[model samples]
Target: MLQELVLDVRKALESSRPQRQADSSFDRIKSSFACQFSSVNPRAFLPWGFVRHRTSKWIWTNEVTQPGGDAPIGARAFRKDFTPPLGKTPAQADIIMTVDNGLTLYVNGGQVGTGGDFRFAEHFCVALRPCLNVFAVTGLNAGVPLACLPPSKSHTPTAPPPLSFPTPLGAIPLRWTPAIAQGAYGVAPWGQITIPSTTPVLSLTAANWIWTSEVVNGNAPAGARYFRRTYYPPTGQTVTSATVIIVADDAYSLTVNGVPVGSGTDFHIAQTYTVNLAPAPYVVFAVVATNGGTVNNPAGLLVAVEIMSQCNCISGAYFISDGSWKFNTGTSVGFELPGFDDSKWPAAVIEGP
Candidate 1:
């Protein structure tokens, strides 16, 4: 019996060693990128009266009018080459051009675009490089006084507001502690873990893009219950109108405030799923899974989950200032019930009104 007990201890130690190694590797992978660029604005030129105007046909030696009677009609034309950052060329980019009254774009000094009756603001973009490169622009209009011009202005000039550019695009790292526990029944049921910080474990370096999280098993004991992590709607956010996304590995069952929302058997692999909840101050998110059930490996289950929100702004632009805006608008925390594993203990406690 003593020899048997020693064998069991050795086995437990051997199993725990791998878990510790996995946890360390997970930490290194998740901490790879330092979160920055939460304060850069890519649309800095918008408010500065920068706009793009396409033209039907190029008009040379044409007179141009000034906005708000700022300048008289004259033969004025200018051109410049915009080289994107080295080794950082985006597939597409927005162009902003401003003209007193009218403007036209030319590729290598050739008439290729045109615009007329300039007033408030005008902007547009054309495909770049690999498609068609080399470009120039010219302004054209009949010199007219702001007063002489009709009450309706085709173009309006405004000063650019304080600008903040977005961070460059790249992958972000994520890491978390796994749930574990010991009990008289041999092992306790595992509970899901949620990232504690209100902010995302990863930050967005670019706008209008997608990212993925890789799930890894960590410190799972034999007979340990299977578990997964999920995202809940931010706390303090109105539930009536809030949209939450939950993702997982293998299979997952989810609920919001105890209300059944979704369940799936195919998610054993890494995947992102979406959930919408009524706007509310706080929303509860939970997930349950089976160990050694569907996934090929039974050693222990490690799942990484990522939550993303889409914006309607142009490329490289987030409607909000930074990723933190979303977190600030909503509250986030983890919830758990008594289970088989001590590591399964809840990482967060939710306080209610």
Candidate 2:
């Protein structure tokens, strides 16, 4: 029994090696770069926003249900403090951000970027110290109604209401595109909004990843569809960590190299899947998405995958959703296989405003 127990312990420890190695590799990269390769806009690649209100939930730029502070209707301040890996000082660092009305950003008590016209969002880069740091943002919710009409002779106009229309400002699209296929909504059951579906992927880097599908129009088919994309890791570099963000209308499951890593059932919020994978020459990514319910129910899939290597290849070479992805609504047995031919599969269609 003691021998068996020892063997079990060894097996458990061996099972953890991949994760530990990845973690160690990531640390080494950080140490080598001295925090120079750190992402400026860590949240830029996500499908959502930063400010989470008790009233408005995760949806971005919606009406604030619970305004805070003495000036309930004025600007709100947000701050996040982080400690960069200790190393050499960075001569220059950058940040990209935007807010509804306007904002003034600060890094370690130094002003980085200030508010803009609210029509355009910009990226900001700055210098940084390699130790503990403070990153702060003051979001301005300008009181003026977004699309308010001026008072007319026929009717009296009170204060205009806040902007209700979804604006592309402040929020960055990891990649913004409409659904590829247009088909009838399916009868897939709407699962309850579980806790996992509501919570945001905390460490996810928002790079404005684009959404893709097989169809070209806004209308998507009712039934489920299969999609696949392939990625070849950079040579001579070890993959340290990988994460994916998926938001589907009805439901979906994502698998890497035949191993299921993440899935989403609720259509409410984006779900994040993270895993430490062993380095490989190539990785196969597949997804099975279903758009259910009545015809009126819209269908789409937005995905973003982040793969970090020992070489720090975060943005480049990583597979992001785009027209380049080959997708098919029909089962083509062996589609998930890396060597399978997809020349006949339709290219992902991009239909969006």
Q: Which portions of model 2 miss their true places by more than 4 Å?
A: 1-217, 294-297, 311-319
lDDT of 1 by residue, 51-88 (tens): 21221111222112321223334423333333332222
Deviation in Å, model 1, residue 159 alpha carbon: 41
lDDT of 2 by residue, 226-252 (tens): 777766543344655667877777888
Q: What is the C-alpha RMSD of each candidate to the true structure, in Å?
A: 29.7, 19.4
Give me the candidate number with maximum lDDT. 2
- lDDT for model 1: 0.26
Clashes of each: 54, 28
User: How does candidate 2 fare on TM-score?
Assistant: 0.39
| C-alpha TM-scores of all predictions | 0.24, 0.39
How many angstroms is residue 235 displaced in model 2 relative to the true structure, after the best TM-score fit?
2.6
